[model samples]
Target: MEYELIDNTQAKQYEYHIEGVLAKIEYIKTKDKIYLTHTEVPKQLEGKGIASSLVHSVLEDIEKKDLTLIPMCPFVAAYIKRHPDWKKLVLKGINIS
Candidate 1:
């Protein structure tokens, strides 16, 4: 499912708000690559699949824009590991193991 992702570029995060809660994936972008630096989901929202959805949508957006990803955040790296197809979206030197 494609969720609404607000790329708050000024803040350098992609935010998803639902049920009065905010989930975000923070990143750094340089030239053709985006380094996913962190991911946050409110404590109350844990175990509810919010993070997975957020990561999925963010990856989709990154792929659509044809930008390479550097999954600096452990969560994002793990997500890529679980979903191997997305690994192709990652930057060449990254090992999402």
Candidate 2:
């Protein structure tokens, strides 16, 4: 799927758009950690794996910038659990449960 991923810094979110629907992963950044706050896919675009892809790309960008992750969103937390390699990007001393 060739989805267009956009880092909408003004909105503090990463958005992936396909056709007219959008999937977004919201975040808040601090000096060293990016707190992922929410993940949402339009109801019309549900069950297409868009949420997973959005978070995957978002995490990749965070890794490239060498910032830690604070998975405040349940979806993002579960994503890190599935992709153990991303666990290293999570900030220390944060309870992910």
Candidate 3:
């Protein structure tokens, strides 16, 4: 299965659409930080790893832009915890174990 992650800058969200359901990670940006605010996936789409894919793609884009992250969204924070390599992307000021 192919998953395409699209950055909808106007909406300030990274979106993934599959089988007519939309999964997205919402963010708010400052000069140097992108605060990941929320994530939502349809009930039918849960457990398919779509949210993980969305977060990963969004983090990759932020890394490429050289912006740090404030993972305000619980889902995003948990994902980063599970995948420690992604921890490097978090903003230094916000302490996370």
Candidate 4:
């Protein structure tokens, strides 16, 4: 399946889609940080690693723009926790709380 990033400014979020289905993430940007706030994948889209792919794409965008991340979304937090190497991309002194 192919995925595309949609900047849904009206909704204040970035949406990732797979074959027109909202497969993974909804994020917002503020200053130099990208806040991953919500994520949802259809039950059928689960277990196929769509979420991971979406996260990777978002991270790539972050890196390209030299922006940091605030993982407000649980899935993003868990992904970061599981992959400590990516922690450097997180904004310093920024608390999700």
Return the TM-score for each candidate structure: 0.94, 0.91, 0.91, 0.78
How many clashing pairs in candidate 3? 0
Candidate 1, residues 3-74: lDDT per residue as tens digits? 689999999999998788889999999989999999999999899888999999999899999999989999
Q: Rate the local accuracy (lDDT) of all candidates.
A: 0.91, 0.87, 0.89, 0.76
Q: Write the per-residue lDDT of candidate 3 for residues 43-97, one digit (tens) a residue.
A: 9999987888888888889999999899999999999988889889897767564
- Model 3 clash pairs are none
Q: Is candidate 1 or candidate 4 better by lDDT?
A: 1
Whole-model lDDT, candidate 2?
Answer: 0.87
Worst 10 residues of 4 by lDDT: 12-21
Alpha carbon lDDT at 92, candidate 3:
79
In candidate 3, stretches whose alpha carbon ends up further than 4 angstroms from where it belongs are: none
Candidate 1 global TM-score: 0.94
- Which residue runs does candidate 1 get wrong by more than 4 Å? none
In model 1, residue pairs whose N, Cα or C atoms come closer than 3 Å (at least 3 residues apart or on different chains), thus clashing, are none
**Top lDDT prediction, candidate number:** 1
Task: Please give the lDDT score for candidate 1.
Answer: 0.91
In TM-score terms, candidate 3 sits at 0.91
| Model 2 TM | 0.91
CA error at residue 31 for candidate 1, angstroms: 1.8
TM-score-wise, the better of 1 and 2 is 1
Model 3 score (lDDT):
0.89
Candidate 2, superposed: residue stretches over 4 Å from native: 95-97
